[model samples]
Target: MADLHRQNEHGSRNRTRFPTQPTPSAPAPELRGHGLRLRPWDAECDTDVETWLRGNSDPEFRRWNTPVKLVDGMEDARESLRLRAEWDAEGKCVSYCVTDAATGAPLGHIGVNDIDHFIRTARVGYWVLPEARGHGVATRALRLAARWAFTNLGTHRLELGHALGHDASCRIAERCGFLYEGTLRGAMFDAGRHDAFRDVHLHARLATDPEPGEGEGKGE
Candidate 1:
């Protein structure tokens, strides 16, 4: 959410590395829980591209988050997916193409991005199709991604942020166990402009933190 998500590709910082704690290089595994399935996006699949395009272009999504590279067309969406695949291959990020478990119908997108193995931290971002909203999709997707990070990657912390005033995102993050951390003034590109700026509400969830509902985590 906000600029934190789109800027993750260039967010890697120069830091000391240890052989025993080398960065991850594993395939993103598919996860299923809470009535949904989370799998990697298929850059080659036309349906995936279509969904990506529609989601990114949705007015509500654009109003909240900012992409470093905007996806305005099918080609742009495909390229974004391709790059996401490359990042997944490098273990820099793990993005999921969220879908309905029963029907396999695409619902939205979620990602555990900018993995820093030395610190065992990552950023989480997501968006649900307009038609899929109000059904707890984002919350479930987030909890699933968090569980994967904590269990699989041993991630110490997972961060989530959204432009200020995005009450819906804040609630979703909190419902998934991401506690409100603070705000970063001018932390994101303003609503529809890249030059202007805006504040972001930061939230975080630590591996040691208690899961929201323990099992299958039900919520709004």
Candidate 2:
């Protein structure tokens, strides 16, 4: 698993500050899916943001994703928001709060990382809140973001990878039309932060690929 807490592809440490909510003159761009919405992280989302951080801090999330430097939940949430803002402003990444389309409740987060304009490629990652699990939130959010990346953001290819044991993430990637590429040996966090690397499975979707509908299995 890639480090969800890190900001840049180069693995450099940086800090970000929360910015004021977008005004009416510059409302945040909205990305919609069948029953989901992806919007820029806003001030009101700190709680959900903290949830995401603390969720990933546990052994369950850490086992499959890159280990995060654990900190106080609220403190990490504040810093995560600022780091996300910095990533966006630096053109390093674009992240969004995944929400319920009708109720306007945040369910999770999804984003593109390690973006390289010259290559027109980026890596896609996401996490679903516990309550959102089994609702197909992650697959929908991922597909929505991938479509926007290819059609609107000039991304030619989007990469998705997960720890070899993360069946759910692999399923979500496949359902979103990412083709299985191969396994990367020792490519992820093993146990603790900076622990030995674990193997990872790589998948990717090209702009020319056809979209897969719901229920699609891991490999077509």
By lDDT, the best candidate is 1
Whole-model lDDT values for every prediction: 0.86, 0.74
C-alpha RMSD for every candidate = 5.8, 8.4
Return the lDDT, model 2, position 90: 70
Off by over 4 Å in 1: 1-25, 214-220
Cand. 2 TM to true fold: 0.80
**Model 1 Cα lDDT, one tens digit per residue, 69-184:** 89999999999999998988887888999999999999999998898775678999999998888788998888889998888777888999899999988888878889999999
What would the per-residue lDDT of candidate 2 be over residues 1-220, giving only the tens digit for each residue?
2464343445434633323222223433789867888988864466666766755665565666664665447767667777767777677788788988999887888888887774578999888776667778888888888888887677888999898878888778777889899999988777665757888899999999987876633321
Q: Provide the lowest-lDDT 10-residue window in model 1.
A: 15-24
- TM-scores for all candidates: the values are 0.87, 0.80
Q: After superposition, how far is residue 111 of candidate 2 from its true place, in Å?
A: 0.7
What residue runs in model 2 are displaced by over 4 Å at the alpha carbon?
A: 1-28, 43-45, 214-220
lDDT of 1: 0.86
